[model samples]
Every structure is written in C-alpha cells, then in structure tokens.
Target: MGVPVASGASPLDAHELLRKGEVSRALVLFEKMHDPRRPDPAVLAGLVESRLALGEAHRVAPLMPHLADAALHAPSKDHHTGLAHWALAGLAELEGDHDRAAGHFRSAGEAGPDDPDLLPWRAGLALALTRQGRSPEAVRLAHEHLTRARASGSAYARALALRTLAAVDGASSRRDLLTQALEELEGIQATRLRAQVLTDLAGVLVLLHEDRGPGVIRLLREAELIAVRSRLRPLLDRVRRLLTRLDQPAGSTAPPGLEGLTPSELRVVELAASGLTNREIAGRLVVTVKAVEWHLSNVYRKLGISGRKELPT
Candidate 1:
C-alpha cells in the first residue's frame, strides 16, 4: 500500500475560504504555495475580491496589470479578465472619476458579453452619463439596461436600473415616469433606492409647491431620513439646503439656530446653508449619500418645519 503524504491546502481551497471570510487560513495556505504563476484565474480573482472587501483598492490596482496580461495570454478568453475590468471600473467610480469608470465598465461589458453581473456597471454608466448632462443618451442606456434587468428579475439590478430611470426622468421633469420608478424601487425593498427616490420626489415636490410650506418640509424630512439610513450623502446635502432655504425668513439678517439638529445634522445644515448639493456635501463630509439624508430628515423634523421655506430665519 502506498503511504498518503500530508499536504497543505490548495489555492482554490484558499480562495473559497477567503470568499467565506476565512482570511487567516487563506493567507496561510496561499503563502505555502510555491508557484506564483500556478494560481488559477479564479484564485487570483478571489484574492482581488478579498482585498476589495478589506477596503484595499490601492493594493488591488497593482494586480490588474498581471490579471490583464494573463487574460490576454490565455488561449481562450475567460471571465476573469472581464472581472478585472469591472474591478477597475468600481475603483474609478469610488474615486469619483466617472469618465474613466465608464470607459472601464464599457470594456468589461464587451469582455463579458452576456454577464448578468455587468448590468450594474451598465446602469452606473448610464447614471454617470446623465450626471454629465448627457440626458438623452443616459435615458436610452437606462431603458436598455432596465429592460434586461426586468427580464432577468434580478432584484438588485432592477433596483439600480430603476434609480437610473428615476434620475433620467427627474432630469426631464417627467413626474409620472419618476413616480413609477419610485414604485419599482419600493417593490424591491431597497432602502438605498427609497432614499434616492425620496430625494428626487422631494426635489420635484419643492418645485411643484409654489408656497413652499409645511408640505415641502415634510417631504424633505422624509427624504433626509431615507438618505441618512442609506448613507447617501449627496441626497442628504440637497435636503439640508432645501430645508435652510425654507427656513430663511423674508427679511431676516441671521440664520436661525436650526434647533434640534444633531452634530451630523448641524454639519449637513451648515453645508446646505452654504448652498452645496447633496453630492458635494457627501464628498466634503466623507459620509455615504445615505448618512447625509438621515441627518437632514432629523433636522427637518426637529424644527417643525413643513417646507424648505419654513426653516428658521
């Protein structure tokens, strides 16, 4: 009988363990491996994913060149190369380089022609386009992605697509379409989606409410909460500014105490008072878009204001 030799774990095993959050075990096993070139694309991808989860984008950047080279050299194109592009796009998006992000996302989509995972990137590209003032193109791309996402019945993808649609609709002042988009988001139970919907809804309501009274305040407050919970700093900032504008008295010289605002609330309020948008506020505060909204909602409720026009003077 042949004796069985005890051996260390495999790279695939390490990758799986890492996916399950067993980082230490994965590292130990991975370190024991001798051939750097031996790890499969899946293993490499997993390592990249692990690094991303650990918030190490910078570390992941160096691996991309190798990943790209590996993909180009492989006899048959695999999904790994496409995934690398996706990762690059995500990193760019996080860094607020939308143009670069869009380019990478497009490349990823071409690499993985039928990948469902790429839907989010497509939707993101559409959003970026809209933000860049390419409304017609954004709407077209959003509709295309929305059709695919709806057909796939992917809750996450659908929610993202709906948000993109809402953005497009909001830009065009198509309230009915935006309303439908909000309903779609609500159906998905996506709190982040709801935050975005509320923010857009509040903005629309503000425009519709000529008096800018308690009703506007109520909408803004609701939007604020949703944004904060979702860490949507941009929406939160918008809500805050809307609130401050509402609070300003016709002839008042000084801004009011903006009573009931928590520290975060005060921060948002101050930013809003300075006329910053939600996106800008989020960047300045280094908070998620949702967090900004949450604070804004709290601020509105505490002040007993109904509209942006009713904020303390």
Candidate 2:
C-alpha cells in the first residue's frame, strides 16, 4: 500500500521531495497517486526516477514501454510529455547512451519549446552531443542555452549552462567558465551541480599542471564529500576512482582501462566473464537486460575490447 498524502498536497510536492533527497517519501507520494490503468506521465516519470535513485530499476523497467511513446501517452499535456522525456534523457545519459539521451532531450524541447525549464535539458543535450564526438554542436548548443540562461536571470540555470559550456571548451577557457559557474553557485542549494563543477575544475587543473602530483585533491575531496552526503552513487563512485588515481603513483593503480570501469560496469564484466549471459546477469542483478547491455557497452569502451569474447574470464 502506498502512503497517503495529506489534503491539498500537490504532485509538485513529490518532485520537491525527490529533489531534496527524500526519495522514499517522494516515491510514496508518486505511487499513491499513480493509476496503473492510465498512468500519469509526470507521476510515472517521478516513480521511475525515484526508484532508480533507490537502486530498484528493475521494478520500473517493465513500465518503460508506457513511457516509450510519451507524446501519445500525454497528448493533451505537452508539459507532461516534456517531463517524461527529460527524465528518460537523464537516465540514458547516466547509462552512457549518448545518442538516446540526445534524441530524448530533443523530444523534450519539441514538447515545450518556450519553457524556461527546458534550458537545463538543452544543457544535457549539449553534454550528450559532446560525448558523441560532436563537440562543435555541443559548444554551440551550450552557448545558446547560456545566453537564454543569462536572459532569464536565474543564477542556478545560468550556472548549469556555464558548466555545460565549460565542459565543451578548451582547458584554459574551461577553467574560466567553470570559475564563473562557481561564482554563480554561491549560496545556492545546488550541491550536485557544485560538486560536478568542482570535479571538472579539478580535472582541468590536473591537466594544466601535469608536472604536479595531486595538487587539486582538495577540490576533488570536497566533491567526494558532497557526493557521499547526497547519496549520489554514480558521482560518488567516480569521485572515489579519481581520488584513487590522484593519490596513487602512476604505476600503482590498475591499467587505465580497468581504472575507468565504474563499479557497476566492473560487476557486469565480471559476471559476463564468469559465463553468465546478459539475461542471466540481468535477473541476478535485479536490473533490466537493457541495463546489463549498457553496462557491457561501457565496459567494452573502457577496456577497448570488441565484445563479450574479449572480456576476461
């Protein structure tokens, strides 16, 4: 049974709960309002997002077919479609499916072309494009979003847009843009955003000072702290690996390929190497077959391998 909300409680309140990291409460609210027969796109999006954050992706993966045609599902509510697309885009990006992320983000924009809330979604598309080896397009898109972010006069949105531009720019320009973003983030509740920028800034600083050893550990350490406190598993894992890299001697850590594998990817690779098929692995891990495939894809890319045959047993 789902927990009931008090009288006058709004769905937006559920979204706020999720944002505030009260994911269980948010899940209760979304589930309480959810109707399986005619799923509310917004509630469905929130449901999946909350479950994913809580490490229960399998529970929601079966519902993905409903979200696959968000526009058709919410024909009368363009914002509902936009919200669903945005949620799916974020999940795709996290899974390293840049093409899918870009496509879904585009769908979001088409759903709500003039919505200010779409600015950050555009920034997400920029990052996805960057990963797909289209840095020029990414830079152009981020710059356009930055202009809109500035015009809107929302420092939080502007900071995010600036961070996107920084991500696509050269190292020197990256530093300047990220610094400007940090300036805008001051006194804001954007802990995740701040941690991300700090991580990027630390990487840029390390690249610029190759002669030095872990001089920017302070920055990365702060990011690590924030990610841990916020329960940002993916970012926390990344920060831990980066921290390991910075702290260890050049030859002390695993090979670059092994080092790059996220904990989730490493687990997938291990299971595959142990002679488990993707379907078996998905069942074992309580994730979707698609999720298992996504992990393998990331593993293959990081390890520079061709396919399942190349994975170590």
Candidate 3:
C-alpha cells in the first residue's frame, strides 16, 4: 500500500519491502521469482531472512541446506555470495553455533571489506565474538566499525554499531550505549530492527542495574509493546522474560532526575526516556497530545533536562 512495488517487482523491490517490514509482501515477491532447482542465492537468502524474522523456524530449517548449497556454488567476489553467507551466519546464530556463525560472518566480511555494503557482516561478527565471551575483542572490532558507520552517516549502520557496542559493554558500563542505540532506532520507522534493539536494550538494562526499578520496568514495557505490535515473536518473548526478572523484588532505589516528580510526570519521563514522541505517548495514554507535551515539559523542568534525549533511562 505504501509503494506500488509489487507490480513487476525485482529483487531490489523485495529487498526494499523487507527493509520496510513488509515481510509477507517481500516473501510474495521472492517466491514469485524463485526457482526450485536453481535458486538465486540473493533471493534465497532474502527469503530465508524473511522466514526467520517471521518466527518460521521450521520453514527456515528446511531451506538451510539449499541456501548453503547455493552459497557454496556462488562466486567468491559475488555480493550475492556474501549475502548468502550472511544468511547462513544468522541461521548458525539462531542454532547457537557461535563459532560457525563467526566463521560465516568472517567470510561475509572478506567478500567485500570496503564495499560499503557489508556493515551487517562486521556487526554480526562483533556480536558473534561477544556471544563467544570475547567481549574485549568485540568491543575493539565494534569501535572500529562504529567509526566507519559514523562516517557513512547511515542510521541503520550507526544503530547496528551501537547495538554491538552495547552487547560488548554489558558489564563494564551502564546503559548509555544501549540507550543511544534505542534513540537511533526510535528515529527510524523500521519496526523490526527497533523491536530487536528494544529487546537488546531491555537485556542491557537488566545487566546494568544502574537505573531505577520503575524506570527500567517502564522501558521494558515500552519494548514489549513495540515487539508485540511488530509481531516480532523472538524479541517479544525476550522482553517478557526480562520483565519477569525485573518484577522479582529488589532493593528499592529511585534513580536521579526523577526525584520530586508526580506519578504522571514520572510516567511521561519514562516514556520519553524510552524514545516515544509526545504524540505517541499521548496515543498510548489516551490523552491529548497537548497534555502529553505539557507533562513532558514539567518533567524536563523538574529533572533539569532540556530535551527528550536528555531524559534519564
């Protein structure tokens, strides 16, 4: 509905649709173009990715061997080959094969180190390293890629780099990196990636334990809402699991910047911290947007913060 791309759509159209979270539409396009005996590696990879994102693990499992075979026959320098490897890496990660995933990600990276299109490979490798308990190396790799991502000025790249850094920096720092990642993701209209980042941010908040209980709970709640709205089952389940952990009783401690605020003001502050715009917050609360803005203004004044970005997470 957003774009008339389905008519005579190409793989690029499918890719764009996938980026926009129209997984079913993208799948239709890919299925129309796919050949059983000689599948295009790029389209096959995209199909695999869409299925995985939709929580169709059974479907993706059956497709894996074919996708791998296609990747095997693909040329070394072919970008489609790299994409196939990237899809394989994702599948490996899903199966908890960190070593294999890292290897595949490395292959993806080698296929096009400076192609300006393999940021996902770099980010995936960094995540794989973190999962393998190589956080220091992950941090270093992610830092280098963060520099490149910043230079690219692409929000997606920056969000990935920020998420990677947040994953690697779990124990060493507070929730700043993950918070920045949330801010970056919130600015984008990509629901799928935003849900993923929200899930990651919830996990990071649980690990950090630096934020107040109320605020952390609020952030996780927002993430759960988004995950459910986006139908991202994996992230939705994760947010639910993390919320259980947060619900367990812990020592009560209110984080700074929230002192002396009424419950209404506090709620506004929490929503803002979780990266919702005033209009969104109003819609969520069934209140007027002007009322939401007024509440946020009071919250900022009380917290001595100037903007939504300055809200404490």
Candidate 4:
C-alpha cells in the first residue's frame, strides 16, 4: 500500500529526518513514497530503519517482505540495498538473535557502496559476537574498526565506532572512548545516535564512581529528553530500563564503589569472585548464565576487568 508522494517532499528530507532523530516524520514521507509494485529501495530502507527506531517492530515485521525489493532497485549513493541488510541486522539484534544479526551485518558490507562496512557494520558485528561470548575477536574487531574510522576522517563514523568499542571493551578504557565519541558527535546532528552515545557515556560514569555518577545525571536526562521529544519509544524504554536496573532499593547498603548494584547483583559478584565460571555461578545461584554475565559486565565496566578470571579470589 502506497500513498502518493506529497508535493515537494524530498527523500533527502526524509533521510535528514532520520539523521536528526525525527524518525516519526521520516516514516511518514517514506511510506508516502513507497510503491509496492515498483518499490523504491531507498524508501524501503528508510521505512525499515524509521519503524525500528521508533520501536515499531510489529509494524516492520509485516513489511519485511518489502525489504527484498531493495536489491531490485538501482543503487543510490545511499546504498539502499546495504542499508536494507543493515537495518535488518538491527531488527534481529532487537529480537535478541545476535547470530542472525551478525550474518546480516556481514552481508551488509558485501552488498555494495555506502561503505557502511568500513564505517560502522564491523562495530555492529563485533558487538553481536561479544553477545555470543566471542569476546577476544569482538575486542580485536572493534579496535580495528575504530582505527579505520579514524583514518577515514569521518567524525560520525568515528563516533559510531567508538560507541561500539565502548560496549565491547571490558576496561576503564571505555570512558575515554565514550568521551571521545561524545566530542565527535557534538558536531553532528544525528540526534538518535547521539542519544545512544550519551546514554553509554552516562552508564560508564554511573557504575565506575557511584559518588560522582548522579552528578552527571544531565547526560542520561538529556538523552531521555531527546527520546521523548522525538517520540522515540524504543529509546525511551531503554533509558527507563537502564535506570530501573541501576537503581538501588531504599535502605540497601551496597559496597563502596558499587552503589548502583542491587543485592542480587552483589550476590552474583561474590560468587563470581570465588573463581567460579559463569555457568558454575549460574547453577549455584539458580539463575541463567546471561544473568551472571550481565552482573559481571556491570562490574567490569567499573573495575577495569574482564570475566571471572580478572576478579579477585
């Protein structure tokens, strides 16, 4: 189903809306321009990205069939086909299918120009790998991606690379990377991307020095403001979820420097520090390995460590 492209409604404006984090408006224009019988690849790509950005996965699910048409259209400077795969990778990541997301991210590079592979998909792939417990390669790939992004001289690319690196890295190095990302992003008007980077930077600040964390509440608050202003439901949900996870209950005394952690998280840390594998700890705690990993990830962000091996015995 396609509505007539509105008079003077340029696709460039739609793309710009995405860049500015005005995804709801971008989606409207893309929808008006899409024609199923002779689909526009750029429109299809934009539609998918905009829908997913707004947390409208259910909307995109039914429209997935239209994505294939991206390959059938001429390759624009935007590399519509590559973007289709890239957007699909994001959708898979949202669905918690990192294996599937990794595959699509790789295919995104092979599709053609738009050169997302060199700029950002490698970082995406690295994150997907990290989620699957392939940390060694993930770290290597993300660092390499950041290096390439720096060499390419695109601040936006560098910011994207740094943000992903921040996620995959297990050390205090992340704060510097996140700080650099915020600086690079400062010059760009990519609102949605900036919001995410801000959130990451704020997370590092919170877990590492709880005493100083709330002082930088401005960052997370700013991100939340952006999400709300843009009607970015998914981003808003993520921000709230993060706050909920990090918040301590009233009167619960967390260990020094671990003020954001809950009693359950503290228990996980204790078991992990005893030289037990995540699996071993999960069994003892009657929780999933992912739960253990999540707790350990928080600890690593604060303590500059990796997994159990780095924890004190």
Winning candidate number (TM-score): 3
Q: Looking at candidate 2, what is the lDDT of residue 27?
A: 66
Candidates, ranked, TM-score? 3, 4, 2, 1
- Candidate 3 has its poorest 10 consecutive residues by lDDT at 248-257
Q: Which pairs clash in the backbone of model 4? A: none
Query: Which lDDT value does model 3 have at 178?
Result: 64
Clashing residue pair totals per candidate (backbone < 3 A) = 26, 0, 0, 0
What overall lDDT goes with each candidate model? 0.58, 0.71, 0.70, 0.71
Candidate 1 lDDT: 0.58
Residue-wise C-alpha lDDT for candidate 3, range 90-114, written one tens digit per residue: 9999999999999999888876644
Query: Per-residue CA lDDT of candidate 2, range 1-313, in tens?
Result: 0123444556678776665445555666776677778777788788878777645666776667767766556664387788788778867876789999999889888887544434266787888998999988888888889888999877777888888888875543888898899899897666667888888888777777742355578777677766544445566666666667667322212222466766677667655764567996797678999999999988788778899888753
Q: TM-score of predicted model 2?
A: 0.68
Error of 4 at 55 (Å): 1.7
Worst 10 residues of 2 by lDDT: 248-257
Candidate 3, pairs of clashing residues: none
Error of 1 at 119 (Å): 3.5
Taking all chains together, the TM-score of candidate 1 against the true structure is 0.50
Q: Give the residue spans of candidate 1 off by over 4 A.
A: 1-87, 90-96, 113-118, 131-133, 169-173, 207-215, 229-235, 248-313
